[model samples]
Target: MRCQPPSTFQVYIWLKSKQSCLLCDETTDATFPICTGCETDLPWLGDQCERCALPMPMAGLTCGQCLRHPPAFSEVVVPWRYDFPIDSLVTRFKHQGKWPMGRLLAELLGQSLHYRFAEGLPRPDCLLPVPLARKRLRQRGYNQAAMLARWLGTHVNIPTDERLLLRVLETPAQQGLDAKARKQNLRKAFALADGARIKDRHFAVVDDVLTTGATAHALARLLMDAGACRVDVYCLARTPKPED
Candidate 1:
């Protein structure tokens, strides 16, 4: 038989355009690897809530809220909590649409996921980025979650199916909304895109951050309603519990 083709993974990491790896600007060629400093920062989720993946006192496996009523998605794998430098990174990337940081954040999420799923977390069948409102997409010119989803799909060898879902109802942004308001605003806010033949898929939902999870929870419920077997959330950061 004629020599077979290079697989998609091989084609994926193959440097196109001599690109600079995010976070550390290093030229790519045949020999040198991507920046290890960025690699280390990306590979592990330090001291987090086992259930929600919020960086918390490792003393407890689950937070009080999670203990009271667990969420729908399986264990969330988050590299950092929403604080310190991460809040700045997320704000710049999401609100300001700093596109490059999306790659850096995705690289970390992918690496952290590699450590988790490689050791065997049962990788999902497809990656669905948290959908953006059409209005927001128009204003920002891109969905940073979608950007992160692309990197993750390449790194982990899953298809990034952006068209699998849609944010049909444009709700008020979640930032200023209180917990009850957040839930109400996000309810009925999303739906599976028409003609999406997604039956029996296990999806990993990628996003920049997980705040109260009202948005993600709504999305997960939608996916489940549309026949997704399960959902796993992969996010760059998970917000710490709001102090009383």
Candidate 2:
């Protein structure tokens, strides 16, 4: 006799048994690798800048910096603060080729986007992964932001166009740079890919993290110059500015 396929419950059990939480290494019933408890314990962004998503003391208002000199992007959405295990996970994913960790983070970010969309956050016409310079792509073997964008696109049903944005300059990494320096370093770093057409469309630039927002701003400016009507930013985590 021919064998039969397993029931849905049996398949669920099999998947649950095969998955373990990335943080605690405990087996989880959820489809994602992170357990519910560990997910809840991650450093979620609290009161933040309405425009830049920078962690702040107040919510539902734009920070002074944004009000003084607005970023090119109209809005920023990040689910986590740059802290603790989230930072460690981002490091492993970006520098160590730890793809599983990236997937976990992307899933969480997707969930945040889903809820935001339900709560009246505007969905973009397309998603653009912040492009990596060719040299950096070669060095890293893959672009972590592109990977996250693909995963998020699949989860959230948004179309992603990787070829629309190009990282034309191989500038030094943004780490250790102050906000002003970061902006200057990326001034002419991004460009539109040839034949790209985003006229009157809304798009979100996707990245693994938002630090000084320099890179995102550069890309957003490029997109706006390319005739995109609106540009938003989506990232896994946001780094708060240091106090003077």
Candidate 3:
């Protein structure tokens, strides 16, 4: 006699026994570290701008700022809003050099991009992790964006080109700066590596968080100037604009 397939309940029990929630340490039947409950509790972005992924009042509507001044990138793919536990987690991962936290976040973001691709989002030709300044890389010991990009690229089967974009300037930290100041700070900050070839290519810049989008804009402009036909931003989180 042929063996029968396992029931859904059996699979669920198996998963629950094998995995535990990252946030609460509860037994879970999910693949990722965070359980379904904690994932639902995440600051997931909803009804966001099609161009920039900024949270908006309604879905499929462009934000007023993008309408007024278009961004350099064609579109942004962000999985979460920068808030609460996510902010805390990103801080610990990015600043504290917590590799486990960074890996978990990148895995979740990769899953989000996979779903988006299933839902008709076009996969870019390549992924470019926004380069960190030499000074910052030396200080941090690793580039957080590069790590995220490698993880995401491996999961999604996209080529990650870390050498295409170069950070030529070591600017001050972007925290506490207004949009104008941020833009000014990023000006002349990025450059293309010598002998890089990107004509007619579509690329996505991967990062951990997008606040003010100054860095994305600067990098996208550099890529375009270097013959990239389309540039997109793929970030784990997008922060809302601060009120005046």
Candidate 4:
């Protein structure tokens, strides 16, 4: 028997099922925007500090800084390093308002978190996006962290509270600043919204990247002081130390 050619409608459906990889522009399935090759090329974090997620030479080690002064957050969960294409993807999503990129990253992070939860990591009562300054919020027209949290919430079946944390002070941007400077800039920068329920609840703070741990430290400390039982940091990428 001879095979019959597909109809025009079948061809249209096949074309619609394909999508473009955001990084390499190669054809991909409609499910994930990035192709498998591009996704594998992403800088996946490996052998990092267990607490802060800083990349290290070996696994199961804590960075000296964390040992000296433990961060208020219990643990940092990140899937990738802030290198190459991950950084570019975050920049486009955060600065250029490319939401698809953010959603893709969030979906991957959610999968990682789900696996961790199955491995006995405590699920937080709520997810809180690190609050953005009003000026920056107005300029950007959206909070990337908030968007990430919302997408992750939907993926993992958790609740997100955008208003739970508030950025009360509009300080200079943290970019180009040293760790100390970033910490100083965030001093008195965040506060809980009015009547926020705090005591005895576990929380996860969501952000696009964990750079110097300054912002995460500040927010985690605030939540800890407010009587949060446990606070975890969840971000898409963790930057390696500059000195490394």
Better of 1 and 3 by TM-score: 3
Scored by CA lDDT, what does every candidate get?
A: 0.77, 0.89, 0.88, 0.93
The weakest ten consecutive residues by lDDT in model 4 span: 6-15
Residues 80-143, model 4: lDDT tens digits: 9999989999999999999999999999899899999999999999999999899999999999
After TM-score superposition, what is the CA distance of residue 79 in candidate 3 from its true location, in Å?
Answer: 1.0
Tell me the RMSD of model 4 versus the true structure. 7.4
Where model 3 places Cα greater than 4 Å from the true spot, the runs are 1-17
lDDT per residue (tens digit) for residues 69-177 in model 3: 8988999998899997889888898999888778888999899889989998889999999898899899999999999999999989999999989888889989999
Worst 10 residues of 3 by lDDT: 8-17
TM-scores of all predicted structures: 0.81, 0.91, 0.90, 0.91
Clashes of 2: 0
Give the C-alpha lDDT of model 4: 0.93
Clashing pairs in 1: none
lDDT of 2 by residue, 1-244 (tens): 7377655435333423557888999988787888889988999999999999988887787888898989999999899999998999999999999999999899888988999999999999999999988988999999998999999999999999988888787899889999999999988888887888889999999999898888988888888887889999999999888762
Deviation from native of the Cα of residue 140 in model 3, angstroms: 1.3
lDDT of 1 by residue, 94-125 (tens): 87877667666777577768887768898999
